[model samples]
Target: MDFVNEDIDNYAYDHTQIEDDLLWRLELETYDQLEIPQMLTGRIEGRLLKMLAQLVEAKRIIEIGTFGGYSALSMAEALPDSGYLITCEMDPVAIQFAQRFFDESPHGKKIVLKEGPALDTLKTLTGSFDMAFIDADKENYLNYYEALLPLMRPGGLIVVDNVLWGGRVLNPQETSDHAIHRFNHRVKDDHRVEKVMLTIRDGVSLLRKR
Candidate 1:
């Protein structure tokens, strides 16, 4: 499951920029109160999200999942004051939990959490996006990719999380594992986008619409 050694992961965490106070509190509270706190983006991945947003000069961003609001907040922090992020979430519990943290952070104002099915939410969205992050249900990863690719501007980035699915992607058996494997290949075969898969925390795939 660990793409890198445990010691290397720890070293990477130690060397990466420390998460800000709000994010630190969010991380701690998520572990304390949430059922699957591991879902939080954590330090390294959060920093990567922030940097990716900045690299794209992202003013308009769309996020498919708003777990504990950590990832949304990280990307939103890179946005200019006028820029905004629209994040879709179907779970009422997660929405409530993430909304609380969104309210407390100054960057939260830039985030608009859309409640309901991500596919339904994606349909309602309009305009080109500079960047997008997909970290929702594994079963619909391919569907999300198809829906989002058209919305991204040329050169815009789409970040897909949990592509490795804890290494289940290698010899996929469960429905979710197969779904992720299928999604990865779908992106690989698509000529419309250039893709690169990173072995970071459960694996991350970066797809740039070409």
Candidate 2:
């Protein structure tokens, strides 16, 4: 189910900016300890997240799923001195895994770990965020978008991960793929924002709210 060609992806990674030592350690440890290490965002997507954060001049970031904390750390590294990041994860084990690395990194202080259903955590949060990243349960993609949209600062960015669902979104072979397809269609039709869906990693949709 590789949406991206391995040769092309590897070549791109080889040519792109290298990840820092902390991220390299996290990447290695994830493979060493986790059953589903692939869930870690890896290098290309992680670097993209950091670049987006920098471009947006993000002072505050909200991450819906903090699997292994790679994405959170990537974005956190780009944040200014006063910037902050909030990452939500429901799995206790995953939170623990992410926390260990977050604690070790200097960027960890800027990250707030919210351990609960992302929707519940989103509801309790106040104030608009500069950027939001959604990569959690696929079934609730639209719901997450709706919940986060109103809380996003005007013109802020919202990045959704796994929109392609490994090319299955085109055929929609399963419930999750079907839902992701529907979500893609929903975003495509939204008139309030400008969106670009990229074939990066699995798939990434960037929306800038108007």
Candidate 3:
């Protein structure tokens, strides 16, 4: 179920700011090579993530997922020369695919791909982050939220993707849908942050730590 009308979504895509040549190439290559190419952040959300990072002036960022590195690269483009981004991914195939693009992008130097379970990788990470992007497996949405919340500095931003789970949260049946529903509620009730769910894409929830 599309939260945004198909035509409207395409219109927005058409009207939105364009990405660089490298990102365009990456998007095409991902669609060509990957089984689940939809996982790539695409133009709209990728630009949004870049804008959010820039808005926050995020020198330090962490990402829970690194599918094809599209989102990771998007955020990294917002960083300055001294900026740093650590993205965690457990899939070897995805890691390899994303690494190639990262190595090619000028902003790629800002990104460090951590290969392992995101939960475990988070444990080894240190220092407060200015922003975070969570786009990993749905089952661990809440868990990732819980784990990453403490790592976020006060007033830091946390952008969570796919909260709507293709609109399944309205009448959740699958375990992934239920997990996202629970995550939405959990964030809604949490007092440590201020949250707003946007209808963009599959549904993006922006959380500001207070």
TM-score of each: 0.98, 0.97, 0.98
Q: Model 2 — which ten-residue stretch has the worst lDDT?
A: 1-10
Question: Model 2 Cα displacement at 128 (Å)?
Answer: 1.3
User: How many residue pairs clash in model 1?
Assistant: 0
Candidate 2, residues 17-89, lDDT tens digits: the string is 9999999999999899876888888898999999999999999999999988999999999998789999999
- Tens digit per residue, CA lDDT, model 1, 1-210: 568999999999999999899999988888898878888888999999999999999999999989889999999999999999999998788899899999999999999999999999999877699999999999999999889988999999999999999999889999999999999987888999999999999999999999
Model 1's alpha-carbon lDDT is 0.93
Cα deviation in Å at residue 149, candidate 2? Answer: 0.3
Model 3 / residue 114 / CA error / Å = 0.3
TM-score, ranked from best to worst? 1, 3, 2
Taken over the whole model, the C-alpha lDDT of each candidate is 0.93, 0.91, 0.93
Tens-place lDDT digits, model 3, residues 1-210: 357778998999999999999999999999999769988879999999999999999999999989899999999999999999999999998999999999999999999999999999998877699999999999999888888888999999999999888879999999999999999998899999999999988999999999
